[model samples]
Target: MSTDASGGEATGVPVTVTADAAREALSLLEGEGMDTDVSGLRLFVQQGGCAGLSYGMRFDTEPEEDDQVTEQHGLRVFVDPASMNYVGGAKLDYESGLQAAGFHVENPNVESECGCGESFRT
Candidate 1:
């Protein structure tokens, strides 16, 4: 992926991965194994949740021909065209603390996120 000051790519199907997040993702992928056929993590949005749309991610073994792929910090991320509209220029971050430990998305396009923090509205 092209490098930029903002994080990674900032245009069309763009996604930036922090080094911490990339390490976490790589560890998770390694646990899934070659037998599971997981090539990378697929990021997308689904219509639901309290805020109208929920972010979803899962292991993807096969990527669609139209999928936009980006490699950052040694981890591969896949984004479909439809989801790109909502998550372009977003950053994937991993946080670990006494209260919470998980992956969080920092999306510039989001106007607000629900109280539960599971969904967002543009």
Candidate 2:
């Protein structure tokens, strides 16, 4: 994976996005068949979930000032500074199977998660 802007990981945080995972993300977006040239993919953590944290991803057009951007598989990824702690040392992957498939986040910092997999607590 390549860092976006300044070209590096968070000040004290570590994260990795494998090449295969990146390609898979791009593939899924293409398969979605949207009439859009998605500028990139963005990931963030938000509050108010049952587990205290939730992961959010979107196909975006640009980066925000506080975004820690990263690029992989020709797609830009934006992550907010505040979400760094909640997702520290995490990795994002794309999975596919007959029953399920999508972007999956493997976060080491998450301590607890709701049964529905919609929220997490660190």
Candidate 3:
């Protein structure tokens, strides 16, 4: 839940959500480019995909009691305790370009991503 620059906490285990990355996630939600009335973004990890783990996300109006709430650049994000381990030391970003567009993750745990980058293995 706590981390410093370079992503290493006191225990040496990286706590995801860099301050800069957290800020980017917020801009994607309420920024001029977003098209949803999302209250906050939820980050989760699921099994399946070419790799063994997959990333899933959605907008939620309310967060669960056990969810961890972190904010960056005024944008709030809800991370479930279960998914925290997998997504720890990761970042949330929005990619917009002629070929690729939408939300992307800069996950440190990720070993490799599928061709489309829709899935990854840790």
Taking all chains together, the TM-score of candidate 3 against the true structure is 0.69
Ranking of models by TM-score: 1, 2, 3
Question: Native-vs-model 2 lDDT?
Answer: 0.71
Cα deviation of 29, candidate 1, in Å? 0.5
Question: After TM-score superposition, what is the CA distance of residue 57 in candidate 2 from its true location, in Å?
Answer: 0.3
Residue lDDT tens for model 2, 37-118: 4355678888868888899988766667656766655656777778877876788887788999777889988888899777
Estimate the TM-score of every prediction.
0.86, 0.76, 0.69
Q: Give the per-residue lDDT of model 3 (tens digit) for 48-120.
A: 8877778888767656766666555455566777777778767777656898666677888887899877788
Worst 10 residues of 2 by lDDT: 1-10
Off by over 4 Å in 3: 1-38
Q: Kindly list the per-residue Cα lDDT of model 1 for residues 1-122, writing each as its tens digit.
A: 73222344434847889999988988888887832233767889999989999899987875566677777887778888789899988999999999999989999999999998889999
User: Model 3, residue 117: what's the lDDT?
Assistant: 79
Alpha-carbon deviation at 64 in model 3, angstroms: 0.7
How does each model score on lDDT? 0.80, 0.71, 0.65
Model number with the top TM-score? 1
lDDT of 3: 0.65
- Residue 115 in model 2: lDDT: 92
Q: After superposition, how far is residue 112 of candidate 2 from its true place, in Å?
A: 1.0
